[model samples]
Target: MTSAISVDDVHFAYDDEPVLRGVSLSVEQGAFLGVLGPNGSGKTTLVRIMLGLERPDAGRVELFGQPAETFTDGTRLGYVSQHSTDADATMPVTVREVVTMGRYAHAGIDRLNDADHAAVDDALERVDITDIAGRRLSTLSGGQRQRAYIARALASEADLLALDEPTVGIDADSLARFYDLLGELNDEGITIVLVEHDIGVVTEHASTIACLDGELYAHCETSAFLESDALERAFSSVRVANAHRPVGGD
Candidate 1:
């Protein structure tokens, strides 16, 4: 299968602290790959390297069979960034308008044409936000806004979908829905690259699992990788206990 996103011996550093050290991985076409790691483990840095937003100190990063620098921007790769730009108060632009912005990479500030409008409408429907398509983005609940961001990526129609902590701020129900939709997209030939903190939920759907701790610590298929030493090392501090303590009783 063709690889949508590939990195070979990628090394990155900020000052003296090394972020990525010989990090090598690949997201196969139509596969869902998850990046699991701690806060300072270089998850975002890897995403930036893939997007060509940050230059890697060493090694190579390739996207769609070409060098990362070949593509000027993320037209071929769609991204759902970590933070939602605006959430408080209210904004004037409707949900549809926000989604239409995804096509900006291709349209470049032009008015939405027939194809763009259809893409926006379809994206809203895919994320199950069609009912609120006309409503202002800021008026929606936390989950709704998260769905809107996913819709934006859907509208972009990129081959590779990279999400960084997309489930943040979303409720349980919406998070489930988001993952389900991503699976559907992956089945339809969209390669998904996810950097998520939550392990249980991500591993459940991702076909391949990758763990990073300031480098490409672990990269392998899901079942094998999850059981390997890399998984334990990447989540060394991550603990999810079955036994719960009451408000004050442990």
Candidate 2:
């Protein structure tokens, strides 16, 4: 299989506070990779780097065989950040309008033609949000709002979808349905990089697992990851470190 994302000895920091220390991994095409880590563990930072939203201080990153920094096909990549829905809470946009924004890159200055409209329609249907396509985004529940976002990605025909804690604040049923949608998308050959804190959910759905704590503890098949001591080693270190930190230390 082709590699969708490649990271090698990547290093990054927020000023003097080191976040990622020589992290390395590769995500193959058509694979669902679940990134597991505790809070402040660089999971979001690493995913941002992978999606070219942030630059690494050292080492390299490649997306779809090209350098991530130089990869310019915006339509091929989709990202839903941790606070994506929070920003949409007050937007006076309709679900269909939000999904149609994905086609803007392809349409450029030209108005969307028949093909573009079809794509938007298809995306809405695929995500099962066609029924709510005309509803105001703010009026929908968390899960419905998330599905709308995913529809937007699908409308863009994204090859790689990277979501960071997308299920945050969502109900349990919605969470399950959201993962089910992801599974269907992955089966249809879209590469997925999901940065989520729910280890049980990740282990249940993702084909592979990448455990991290400033550095990568393991990157392997989910089954293999479960058999190893990676989670114990990674989370135990977090507990130990937190125990020693001052109440208000940065």
Candidate 3:
């Protein structure tokens, strides 16, 4: 299978503090990859680098075989950040309007044509948000809002979707439904890179796991990762580091 993302010995930091050190991994096409780590382990930062939102300090990253920085096809990539669930109540945008934004890249300066509208409709249907397409985004529940976001990605025909802690404040039933939607998307060949704190859920859903703690401890099949000590090793390192931190150190 082709590689959807390739990270080669990437290093990054904020100011003088190091976040990632020689981290490397590859996500194959149609694969569901779960990025796991303890708090402050650079999981979100790593995903940002993968999506070209942030550049690596000392290594390279490629998306769909092109250097991430040079990959100009904006329609092929979709991202849902941790804060995506919190829709501002003041914004008057409706669900359909939000999803329609995804086609802006393809539509350019011209108005959305028939094909674009069809894509938007298909996406809304795929995520089962067609019923609420006209509802105000702020009026929807967390799960409904999330589904709207996913439909936006689908509308753009994104091949790679990167979500960072997307289910943060979602209820249990909603979270389950969200994961089910992700499973269906992955089955349809969208490469997924998920940064999630829920280890049990990730283990059950992701095809592969990349365990990290300022470095790549393990990158392997989810089953193999479960059988190894990578999780314990990574989390233990975080605990050890925390034990020696100065008072009030961030």
Tens-digit lDDT string for candidate 1 (1-250): 6578788899998997788889888877888898898777789999989877788999888887778887666667788888888543455878887888898887886766899889988999898889998888778786788788889999999888999998888888677778888899999889899988888877889999888877666778889886788866665633212122245655
Give the alpha carbon lDDT tens digit for every residue of 1-250 in model 2: 6599999999998987889999999999999999998778899999999988899999899999999999999989988777765558787999999999989988999999999999999999987889999999999887788778878988998999998888876777677778988999899999999988889999999999999999999999999999999998988885548856789757
Number of clashing residue pairs in every model? 0, 0, 0
Query: Cα miss at 63, model 2 (Å)?
Result: 0.5
**What are the RMSDs of all candidates, in order?**
4.9, 2.5, 2.7
- In model 1, what lDDT does residue 92 have? 82
Name the best candidate (by TM-score).
2
Q: Give the per-residue lDDT of model 3 (tens digit) for 221-248.
A: 9999999999999988955478557887
Error of 3 at 217 (Å): 0.9
How many clashing residue pairs are found in candidate 2?
0
